[model samples]
Target: MGVRGLQGFVGSTCPHICTVVNFRELAEHHRSKYPGCTPTVVVDAMCCLRYWYTPESWVCGGQWREYFSALRDFVDSFASVGIKLVFFFDGMVEQGKRNEWVKRRLKNNREISRIFHYIRSHREQPGRNMFFIPSGLAIFTRFALKTLGQETLCSLKEADYEVASYGLQYNCLGILGEDTDYLIYDTCPYFSISELCLESLETIMLCREKLCESLGLCVADLPLLACLLGNDIIPEGMFESFRFKCLSSYTSVKENFDKKGNIILAVSDHISKVLHLHQGEKKLEEMLPLGPNRALFYKGVASYLLPGQSSPWFFQKPKGLIMLDKQVISMSSDPESKQGVPICTEPESKQEVPTCAHPEIKQQLPVETDSDFNLEVPMYAHPKIKEDKPMDMDSEIKQQVTLVSDPEILKVARMHHIQAESYLVYSIVSSGEIECSNTLEDELDQALPSQAFVYRPVRQRVYTLLLGSCRDDISASLAVKEWFVYPGNPLRHPDLVRPLPMIIPGGTPSLKSLWLNQEPAVQARRLDALLACFNLSSSRDELLAVESPLRALCCLLIYLFVQVDTLCLEDLHAFVAQALCLQGRSTAQLVDLQLEYISPRAVQLGSLLVRGLTTLALVNSACGFPWKTSEFMPWNVFDGKLFHLKYLQSEKGYSVEALLEQNRSWLTRFHNLKAVVCKACMKENRRIVGRGHWSSHHTGRWGRQGSSSHRTSSSCGHSGQGQPWRDQGPGSRTHEHDQWRRY
Candidate 1:
């Protein structure tokens, strides 16, 4: 957005002209040259503090205070050197940039969440980790500036524009920030904080004159180049097609436009020509795309160069100037008050004053009475005007009194003049003293009738034939054993009750005595059915011989499925052991083995099994299935699978394992290499080989040296000197080589 790659490109291209100098050195220079004069610098406070407020810096142990303290010391150092530092903090984002602001806010929230997670996981004393809440950091900065007796301007929109505009209005020394947009605004000087060094504290001033000269373009055409380079309001894609194809042509047009003094028109025409050539005349006819507010994107680009004009997006002039002194700081209360009031003094009178001794002249003044003037009406006037108007006024007042005396007349009068009466009624009602005919509570009671209470019994006794046929000597008992056998009298006949038929024959056997008493053939059939349910074809002896925990776990899972029972940890371990031919293995060891054998395929199977079981459980539960029957349902199978997958992927996934193996192989190969050659050289050669081998590489290197020597000899000969090329001083040759390197 900020002229993509402009800062780096400028620094690299003009490193000699754009030399780095410490801020302290500049302050010293200003103080020594202009003894009593103080150079004021407008600072983009918000932009400068972004690096300090990062999660790594501000989210740890009292860093907010420490950061501001450092900032305070920086401001104080400049103040000591007779440089007035004015800080400008950003305010609400302008309407045009609200979309960008929203995205930034979302990014900030993400950063905050990340910081919180890090502190909770990594810090032993997380409760001590603290920083300024939400907007408190900016407020703290403002407070710090105030304490330092520095004037701080809180911008109404963007601080960048305000900083630039204020610097120009005051003719300050320079504008300081990290923003690259300042390069386009060539008015006043600009410096980037990132270019400053902590050890040297150098400030690299952006030289607009050198930049324009180097680029072969004027200051006015820089914004157009920036537009093509891309900015916040203009998408990079808009000019991406022409960037490589027509950039040189555009630059040439700008450089050759000295014949036509209008640079803007020349650049615009050149752009249209290039577009038509590349995109066709039909595409060129279409209007350029605009910003969100329908402002031409080009206008926003050029607005940076024009000082007084504000861009529809991004830039806006600050409302007023911020000023400060030793005792107090103040800004212009009104933006319209551009001029200062003039002080006036009393002037001496030229005429002589009248004293008491000159009473004769004082008494010559004349006086007048009210009766000296006369008024009259013509005969063409109406009769009412001719007569006294007091009678008519009295008659109208009497009619108003009569209307006020009757409620119906008053109501009709109020309705006829609602606008006048409404204010009076609202005022009275708001005063909270209006009396009503009935209270709200009484009205509510009258509107709603009370309900009466009634009672009825919910239970009724029933007489049955079974109750009458019950034998004597057997007291009725609700115990399950009593229903199956006679009460603890061995001599008494046992009660014979018919058993409920099994819903599905050869289903999974219950882990109870009744199932254990079944014939061996029936038990084998049940075991086979359980194994078949899980798609396992192995016999009991084979399963026991393998003793694989995965198979045992699968068997336990199938048993829960066939019996419609919820899974429990203890029951799972016990059944899994039983499936392993009742092997004597600890639950922990079995669990470890089960986890080791879980593959991606096993995960998919477990996920599907869990999903189907959960669905069946929910359906049966909803259809009035007894809660006692399925209390051990395997509802946590999904959670177990998810945990396993996350652990494996995060800790030992196949991709990660492969990457680790490749790194290990590289390390081993590096260690086995001979010590004579440098690893960096080897790496370079490896990269070069990928591009393709070069033939006669030594010849290419020697040829470059030979050409340089030839040029040096020719220059020496032209100077009428017979000196050899090597005879030149080392420093001079080194400087020549440096220049060649730049080229």
Candidate 2:
């Protein structure tokens, strides 16, 4: 291997002391963990590892390679756990590392020799497995990794990490020259190449714990921690300002690489406000260095990742179906500049136009004459408008015309001109009750009316405006009710200014509307502000916009956590026995909120109760809960302290088999709907995972397919899995030995 560009640097060398020391340390540690277990570790790289790791000049490069080869053989002596030395060329990764790498030098070589040397023979090295994963070097590393069988890697990673954990689980000793940000999955454990030790497993564990503690996280949280710190662990929390500074500092733009290595979006020119660079002009070509600017490039990426403050808050309230408030009127003729703000000032206060006394506020203020105009506009110019009168300033201006020549005096005159103009008013309304003109007198007074309103002959019409809409859009309405407010978004008329996610009909109601009713979404938002709250958006008027099953599941999960009450008996059982199981072990811990106070013994008893109840529900057709059974009932049920499932069946003739069939049908349908989504995803891309529908890319596609699968699956499937129920014995014996323990 020859050193080309920056690869001639020290890092490109074959095996430096630290690299040897680190790998040696890790090898020894693995030996201790599995006394006789010697795992043959492979060096997987997209290119020749020696080319990237070894320097151009070495005191004993051949000897070091021999040492690594020997280490592989020694590890394989007991049990050969083969590792693939796979190399992938990612263009983005390459581009990111361009400045750091030495230039490549092409050399003409015999085709047969090159092919045999680089591929067939070398890939099948003795005692060590090597795989050259086909990939473009210019693409992102994530793309290369994805192509390398994510599902297989995910499974293996999970297993390896679990085996290394302290108790029943395994942990991993992460080793990679690449950035730690690559680990986003919950199970992946990350350690620097230096962290892995060769002595005992304790070194690995200690390193893992120390890293976790330094990051203010648990051992399990390393993946998330890595995502935030970015590469090579620069001082924490520096990523924020780094992006801003980068964008401001540099003006060069790089070409965009797609998932494949093709250049999808070309960088026509670099545009920057700081340097005053413009599009379609190579202004920065002369100013910027020809090579990659690492600091500047990284900062630009950080800026893109950093979202504006308003975007998060804009979606805080899922105002179902955005309706404009007609009450707010802007005096500015420009519609683009005109915006609606919350009505904070009294209507009467806006009647009198105020003059600005302060020069700074006057100069910055929009041309709104009214004092209350500041409430609607984003910028406020006048500070002392209450004390200053435009007419008085004008009168003095006429008396002392010579003062007009002064710049400060001229600015005051400009303020007076603005004060003379009329300002627009934006009015907002709260809830006002309205009655349907066709509603029957008898049905009008009832709290929960099931039937539509019927028109009465010779009856006076009754109706009221609930919440006023913005003048621009009259079709949308914000109606406040005793419990909740409904904002209707007519799909035909999308609020141009604010884009909202369509509410899935039968999905959870809009969070803002729920706020009026104290719904779980609102409760959860209060508990965790980062939680997605509902907002008014397009596609509001559909009679049935059924949310996809996965969306429904998320909705329910959010509801369960947000709701003050513990999960309902049936839901809790289904969540634990089925939902948690589907989520794998990592997320199962998320539902362990209730485990802390209760004893492990008590928990096992409760889990049994939950399991039995879930099993009973699965098997019974009567839809009767197991807690309803007298034998397994908790003593507190008699005292009315614990939860009790409310019975649905009235007749004694109700069959347990029937209830189980019904409940299981519901669960089966839910699963089947999920399956439909999974199948739909596979249809588009055969390689896509069954769980891909849950991914951000496929969420919209799955949602649009809608309720049909759920309805059909719900009605059609028989409760096959739910039918085989063996009672796990009565509660007292099981309650004595609790199993579910809290963290």
Candidate 3:
């Protein structure tokens, strides 16, 4: 549904812009021309590896590992050729697409089920060992990323937007991903492995500027065109049939407009024209109308254009200085240079410092640039200062210096001084004690309005917790948002209540207090209540069999506390495991029980147990379920109920009786038609006409004896002519007359 005909239209109208080049060629070009220049690129890693997670022949068995290894090697290849790669992973499905997310999740589960079924059926087959299951592949990807030490930034929403944003902000050389939506952003170049590579061993670079030119549209107009054409977030039925093609034709015929031109207004005008051309026909407007559709379209526009407004944390400008320690220097530099240089030490001075400059700042001397300095002494120290007291006569010895004749020593000495000076500057700037001539605000005043810096909105409070790793940081962030930000907000989850302890600072609430401090025995007595709440039967014995019934209860409480009914079994296990770890306990047995027993039971009791729970836990938690809120939700155009008899009658021009008659006529026409295939060519020849035409034209071709030598007025006038039925005089006349009558 992405820009309905975008890929094909672009290929036909603007092939040069989407040009592909080989990997080796691209790498060599950069190597020769932009040597030692690391061109930064944002990678949609998840999109790149999506197929690997799904069951595919090329990505079967250990092939996924090979694929990931190959991906790492590709990144390394770029790094070798001076390309800085920043990998971005999708964290959650966007709020606007939650309905689509749910449908996709359901589809994926069905696919997983199908794969499992196939594996079960082919268990004894030799080729059964060919593929790894989707779940196993997903786990392996995480492990591979960790082992490879690829630090990926997880976007809170659409990774494409984040990739586009980062690429724009940093002026990245390009964005590498499979999504064509990046074309809508029009800020950076885009690269795709599939699009770029003609062969397995080749890669290509595409030209974005040329592509826009070919389409006869400016880059800024793409998003509006995409909305009209339809995108993943917007349904194709939202627009009239063939409207996208008309828009493409319209744009292709016109000159490109400036960015200041009202592109959406132009689209609306075109749409109105199309609507008028098909005045009496049933179109998207006749079904859903324009007012609501326009609003949704604009919402999509705002979402993509102003993604930062949704996730403020990601857009926050990082404020800090990068420290260049010895380890950092060694890692960045070649091994040959690591051991050659000594750490620079400052020379002591006895002279009094000025009151304006702090003693700490004054004592920090710039690295000496001289090449003839002694190796063992500080760069500022003279030979006389080391040997004896620095008298007025000794100062003359320092003035008379000799240049180092060896080029290698001089080069090393120069590098050392450069590194030392860099460290000194960093120390002074980061210390924030030195007064600057102009502040950032002052600089902004002198700058053009477009170049001026905009301040980010400040957070009300900053929570600092020692999260061990990225996973913990994500979990903590989610927990804080659920417990603090969304608590008691009816707009989110109307049934959920905020815990009192979470509302108060420094107040820690135990599971018992949150659940009315009910004892284990008391909770057991009220097990019926828990079952009823989830719409489950009271007599479920598996719940009682666990070693710690309380742990199971705690798991349930945590799930409900998060205010999400549906949860991924893996995520629930992880959260429960973390909670147990905090209480100085192990969740090994509890996690096993939850996966095997409790989760299945919960699913049967009308709870959703999706394979991927991020959509619910993170996405829905951030921007509550669309159906629950008063905001307009797009109708499921594909729903069968929309075409039901009652619904059809509700529409102005549609009726069940008319639909039934149309279906019957279609069926009759389909059955009456006979498929004609040429025996010699083994391909479709032509559809046979009526009985008289077929008998006259095809009798000889089918080796049947039928007046082939007879000279008749309307049939077989070319007697014994040895010509095809189409070319024969009498047969052609009869075929045409029959076709005319049939029409």
Candidate 4:
């Protein structure tokens, strides 16, 4: 999507094209030159997100707590310096970029294969070069920033365009990012986020004017250079003939015939010949041996042109774009219209200009700076204006995604859709589809199973409630259809399978009751119902004894045992053992353990539990979200590599106390929790009858229709052969419900 080899070509060959300067130096110069001005930097958030998350040990999965901490430090560095920051995120799928997106994914697949091979062969984690950003990173970033109280916006379209335009519209210090395309835009200055040493705010800025002067080309000629060098709009192959022609004539520097810098120098030399001439179009057409590209060339140049005039006080003002702040979420309908903040962009009367400060109000004292040159406040303050600075802190309640978009989800999940789950809230939602992470493998090398199938049962239950349905019974969830986006990987399913069956007690509150009923007892019933889905039936007093933080996760493990047949008590102990590993750990203290690739079977149990947790969150979101999802997030509860290491310890028959390496009281707590899980999970009982129904079904009498004289024992309550008439999950529902009722 960028110039094929231009970043390196200019960075190495044409030194004038790129400039490396310290950001602290720039800040000092700004302070010394214009002491009254506040420097504002517009940031491309996606660029920073990939950089921050890529170098970690668990890039394949994620270290969310560490990632969240990195984001806080990044923001505070600017805020403490009195530098205002506005973050823009990429939002929609542009028409021509779909193919580009697919190509990159296929490329990443090759890299991912190499990563798997390297980890297994070398028996260690791969270095920084081999990594891809984990799924749901953007959503996580936005959620974190919002929670951090920072000023941010999700773009209605591509963020680079919005970033460049916003920078130019507001007269920003620069557009801070790593994209080479930023050089092509005629916006404000472009800065390199990669070169930034945040501790001192020292970084490099790309000086476009220096490059233009050195190359004998005008600022207007930048887009033409990008096209001639081969960008996203026009294929590089189309200009191969012209590039070789330029390469042959340039003998000053002996390099590869198709070397990027050599070609850049040659092409610009030719461009200099045609500048301000009558033959500009005719001369440029010669480079297009395939055909003339006046339309596309114009389009590429037009993309760099800034649109509209919405300031930060307003917004980008596109159809689906919304402005986010701590106080409110607002959107603009008309491009030509200005919006809130109660400030004036122009003077009320042209005859008399308004001055910011009166002579009497001018400052007389020299301002003092902090240790890091952090100014106490913005140099110039207005008498009436209030500074609503965001709280500089980390994410306290980070609530956090998925492959497969249901066709029905489009009804409410579209851009500008009022629903909170709508993707429009993101600046740029992924145009392409993704497979769910933590998927199980089948028969060794299939096109990978649909991560959808893994979570379908849970999601379908959620879909039934969120989207509504005619059938009131839980079985109605089975009818919901979800479409998975596998990209290049074709699934091996015989019929793509169907709904994942969710098993919970009938007495659990309905979606309606969870939402409308605000009583404390209703909350207790909701938790009970959630646990019952995993078949962990606990009394209120028993649950109160256990910590609430790990209750949902403990219930999740039992659910995994019920769903996954191969899972044993060892697996249950392994997951809980990691929870012990996470006992009161800080963001800095988290052990960065790595892994050598193993069988999905080795870690598939953890994956299943992870998916199960996602289901719980989705269900919670559908209701009023009474539960704190942050407390139950996968990062807080499980680490795949740590689980595998702990599991091996348990496989050798380690006792619960030995596994946790704790005292007798901890053993008591572990044994008690494990006892509850073991009892409820001994047999996968799909349904638990109500108090009155329980007595009638198991102890009252034998079945009316069959063996009326036989007496049923309480021990045979959950037996498969007994009544054959109760509701079930995985087990079939018999048509004998009417016969079991008492008069």
Candidate 5:
């Protein structure tokens, strides 16, 4: 996190330190400074994700197509002005920051609770003001960037560190992001992504030199000043005693920063007096409140420090990972040890930050014994160790085969189309942990199970299948710790999962086996495994016969049908309509329609589909990405507005033909998918009924056409005089869901 209250502190300084200017104008100014040089800015992808999608961002999972379309517009604007942006994202959790991570996650969870509460209390969906970032956005965004052919990197260390380092090393114009930490770094000027006025291409930027000048300190003093005010490594409340003294020592500043500004100014003044004096340990304790480790202050400040020169890895891309002479940082289980410094040491010119990837990262993999998701690691997958690079290279290198798994895994992942998820799959494979980001949805609405939670069974199976490799040696880093999302009280820990093995038709194969073999027989077996996951093992031939364009779509629908505990004809039929809408001009039409209100049911269903899409992406990753990456585009396949509209039409009793009346061409493909979905469910439900797991009374609910009476009484809670199929079997509706909003 950035210095606490620094945004306010900088805002108080106004035009001197921070000012709003057209982004193009700023780029032009930089170009003038460099004469003949192109203006390139290193963008913080995390910050962009938070600020970019405004005014209906994650209201119903996401409007991926539109979101991406808008993202392209922003990028095109940058290009239109001759500004090149290189985006960076974070990966691999830092030990010291877990608490901060948990705190932020819980805070987002509170917003989730509030959004649904507002809906339950008001009987209408909340307005555009509620902000929450959903999961898979980063992966999705990376995909979007790839389509645009933008250069991007997901650091094995931290994105912020890499971003600042890249900017300073390359002598870029500045770093653009909202993170307060950018202010603490003495590298390039920092611009606020939040202050971006997309229409005019204007954004607010902070002049660090001016900020330091106004505060009466040197640029070198910024990090210490930020620490004194509190940061991620240092809590703001940790300086209560110092804060009290600062408040008493100075009167309120004449600036507009208010009380926080007064304290900041006071701290700066105090720093000026003791700047040289606190070089000694005794003087430091006398001047500041610090923990036992004064070195932590150094480390926190050092986290912002950039290497004297850029790493060789950035330039070694296609040439492959060359061994660096410097020792790579160890990912120790003891995080404190990694952050520990015996004494504060300042870096001189030519010093380099420790790289994070290590040789032992490939030493071995450990999987849960008797794992619930029955998957065995593929030991037979042969990979060649590079003859060009040294025997030891960073696991991050694209082709350097480690003692870990197949080189093919990395080769496939490095493809331009799928590189966005490169870190996600790599982290899971290398570290056995997945650092989940914020996924916005109506968790508070009990009408549906938490979408994330609902998918755990799927994920657990995925983890086992992906991480199921057998390695003789296992390390602490290999222990499974997945960042999870669910209802109250867990407080952001990676919730434990007890996965069960899924029985594939021709027996499960190693992840390596999934990718290496491409025989018709092998491909058929892989397809059968995918079908078996959705309870459609018997209909393999039918799925195989589907047109390739509709194959992924059919798999998604069938997956949704299998995953959801219960289903209905209306919901299932609407799913086809939504999928059909993607293949036509409907998304463009949706862009023109103003959808002010969407019922909770539509949001839930749409959110579930989006979640399903991401899960399938994860599945594809686990199975070595047999499907094309383009098949996963949320924008092409999913539009939240379009989904909600179709849902409302279905709720109002519109037939499939009527729902597609605007584009009747969809009717043919629509029924084809409908027949496939109904057949898939019918086969699966027969098995459920045979096992006595589902009641015979509701067997018609998933029948070929789903009799009109069955449609009237299905699990989507279209209330009628009949019991409906539920996960717990035929049951009465739990509660009346307000399907329509109050006008």
Candidate 6:
């Protein structure tokens, strides 16, 4: 009667068992309830065991060990209160899969042998008595046969007796296991510690008494008592229906297995079906319990029934008894009032109303019998009245409701909008204007504030607007170096420009002056033309006719080139800072521009700038430079000679070789500058760079590592713009060009 029976079904092999002898205060009341029982006596063969090895069971870990120790000490204290020790075991088995039938049987035999050895040792203990019973499958088979007159192959053989003996001798039939299947054959009262312990022991005793009265059961014949409670009724049929629901037809795999094995497999599947249904709906089983009178009623019925092990099948049961129809008899099947009465607002004075069946009558036929005695019984009118209530159908009803208050959402929303706006701006720029400023207006109405802040300039061209906005914002906001090396507008929109400007800003000369005079206000005219070009809303043809895209682009390029022309400026200003640092006598008077550019550092910057501009010119041949091409100050061949003369005298104390060696570095800077020029030229040209050619151009300059590397940024890519000159050497002009050379 120990924990063996439960263990067999659940497939557990844990060594320890913990049983609650007295639910609340067994030590306090043991003597009063069972005075005849020996002092230190326990329910021998009754123990509760939980197996962690089963798939259904998880290990309780270290805490469970502590719990078991606590229970053991509690039981030892009970011995002090005059209750003999008792044990109840479900059962245990060695682990092996039944797929290999022979090995599984052999392992079961070995496990059974081990159990017998344990039982014999326990049986020798003084003042000990054991009562064990076969329940579950044994009781199920017996009841099934008694009810259905069917035979089952589920019998314990003589050799199997040795295998089952320990389970029957030392293990309690129902005490320790979670299963209710054993109640079918068990002879004693069964209680689950975790659940039933919550109730008072007196209440438990009362429930048990009522349960026995209902079924007419004695504790010794609990299995027979269970039969009265409908334990053997296979509602929803047996295993075959379960197999159909859970597995494919045997015929599908029949070709792969022998006929006998297939039959055996089906039987096994049926067993599995019954076992699962029994566990799955176990709450219904707990309603049955054991005591004295209910057992006698089951014993009186005394019919033996065995279950059939055959093709898996399910029994169909009466799911629900619905009332189909009712008939008003007038105490007769045929009513005399079949004719219809006229429809009227008021009850028509005494025209005999022809009666049809009541609405409830039409719905209650087939289930409720039409007989004289039970015609209008209200009790059986509808069995489903309680089930018709509405249920809460919302999926989120169980979820916690909360409002979002995080600022990260708004920050992200703003960033996203700025990025989108930047793209729109890119789509609007044109080559005709250089000084165009795009003012993005946040047009975000309440509808989609998260998507965008403003509408871009062009209404129809929205395709690239968002992307353009985002690209610009990302470059600006991140502060990545050289992010916008070339930050010119996409291209000057042709519509924004005009035919001409009377005068450029900064008192610079106009294009009219440049074209009209030989040397009249050279800087002023160049500046005037730049301003005019940016302001004019003229097409390329008109602009070229007036002062060419080439002229405008060249002027702009040269101005930037001069500003960043590292070596020329470097050479011109190197001596200024030195003279001041040494407080040397003024050998030569310097101009305002020359005096202000006082550092040798400017020399290196000038070299880089010159090289950069040269590269820009070479690369951007399409529309000329971004600035006016006419403004290019061709290198003076005379300056080269002047440079050589200065080096020979060592007037600057810098060597000629040092200056000459800078050619390579200058060429590299020149290449990158040329690339920018080319892009600007294309920007002016209106013809997009061919996709394949541009990609090749990009890869050749930037390589696969992209624009991140500083040492070898591409010649034409923009990320190279911020690089500063690292080496300063003697000044060297790239090629000796005549000053003021005409194209």
The prediction achieving the highest lDDT against the true structure is 5
Q: Put down candidate 6 lDDT per residue, 1-743, tens digits, no spaces.
A: 21112223222211122233453354345445555543332121222222211111011001112222334443444344443433321111101111122233334334433433433445221121221111111212122222322211111111111112222332322232333333332223334432333223211211233333332333333332223322222111222333343235433335554443343334334333343355324421232231222222222112111111101111112222122111112211224311111111111111112232543234333221222222211111011211231121011111111111122322222222222111111111211111111111111111111000011101111111111222343323211000000112112111121111123345433222332345634544443333333222222333333223234333334323222212122332222122111122121211110221112222222222222223222222111113432222212111111222232223354543333333554334334433443343334332223223343323222112223223221321224232211110111111111111101
Each model's RMSD to truth, in Å? 39.1, 27.3, 32.5, 15.2, 10.0, 39.7
For all predicted structures, in order, the TM-scores are 0.35, 0.19, 0.38, 0.63, 0.77, 0.18
- Candidate 6 lDDT for residue 633: 21
Candidate 2 per-residue C-alpha lDDT over 163-201 given as tens digits, one digit per residue, 9 for 90 to 100: 121111122333232222222223223333233333322
Candidate that would win on TM-score: 5
lDDT of 5 by residue, 1-743 (tens): 67888877676554578777777877889888999888988898978987667535466667677677778888898899899988877755565567788788778878877876775677565766776665567777877887888876665545677678677767788898988888877688788888887778888778888877877787767777877888877667767678769768766457545778788888888777655454443434345665554545544554554543221111111211112222112132333432222121222311222222323233222221011111111110111122233222223343222323654554454332223554356666555556665555555443454455455555655555665563546422234466655554354346433333566765777766776776666665666555544445677776766766567767777766654434556776666787677667544666675554657666667767777677777766666566666776677677777777777787678877788866767888787777886687566552212112344454323222233222232333445332221222221222111111100
Per-residue lDDT tens digits for candidate 3, residues 1-743, read: 23555555555444566655554555466556666655676777766665333222221112233345455666566666556777665544444564555445444434434443443455321233443232223323433454456545544344676677677656566787776677776556777655544234344455556655554555544565676767767776776544544545555243543321323334535544454354335423342344545435544443344212221101111221111110000011322221112211112321112111221222222121112111111111212222354342133222222122222322222222222111111111111010001010111111111000010000001011101111443433221121111101122211111111112222222212322344554434234332222222222343343224132333233323122212222222232222222222122321221111112112111111111121121111111111121111001000111112212232224332343333554333222211101111111112222233334334323122333222122432434333222223211121111110001
Candidate 4 lDDT tens digits, 1-743:
46778778767866665667765556666667667777788898888876666335553345666777788888898888777788776654443454455455456656656655665566555677765565456655665676677766655445777688667766777889988788877788999888888887777788878778866777767766777787766667767887788767755654553367778877777666643353323333343443444434433444554433211211222233211111111222324321211111121121111121212223221221111111111111111111121111101001001122232232223322211232321211112222232132222223122234334444444433443423345333333222232323422211122232334445535555665577887776666544443334543345556686677676665555444333456767777776766564565656555443443444435444555665665555554355676656655665555666667677667777777876665566677777656655554442222223333334322232234322222322435343322211221221111122110
Error of 6 at 660 (Å): 71
Assess candidate 4 and give its lDDT. 0.50
- The Cα local distance difference test for each model comes to 0.35, 0.23, 0.32, 0.50, 0.59, 0.24
Clashes of 4: 9
lDDT of 2: 0.23
TM-score-wise, the better of 1 and 6 is 1
What's the CA RMSD of model 5 in angstroms? 10.0
TM-score of candidate 6 relative to the true fold: 0.18
Better of 1 and 2 by TM-score: 1
C-alpha lDDT (0 to 100) for residue 16 of candidate 6: 21
Better-scoring candidate (TM-score), 4 or 6: 4
Q: What's the candidate order when arranged by decreasing TM-score?
A: 5, 4, 3, 1, 2, 6
Q: Which stretches of candidate 4 lie over 4 Å from their true place?
A: 28-38, 54-56, 92-95, 132-138, 232-235, 238-258, 269-272, 275-301, 308-452, 459-548, 551-563, 587-589, 592-624, 639-641, 663-743
Candidate 5 C-alpha error for residue 24, in Å: 3.7
lDDT for predicted candidate 6 compared with the true structure: 0.24
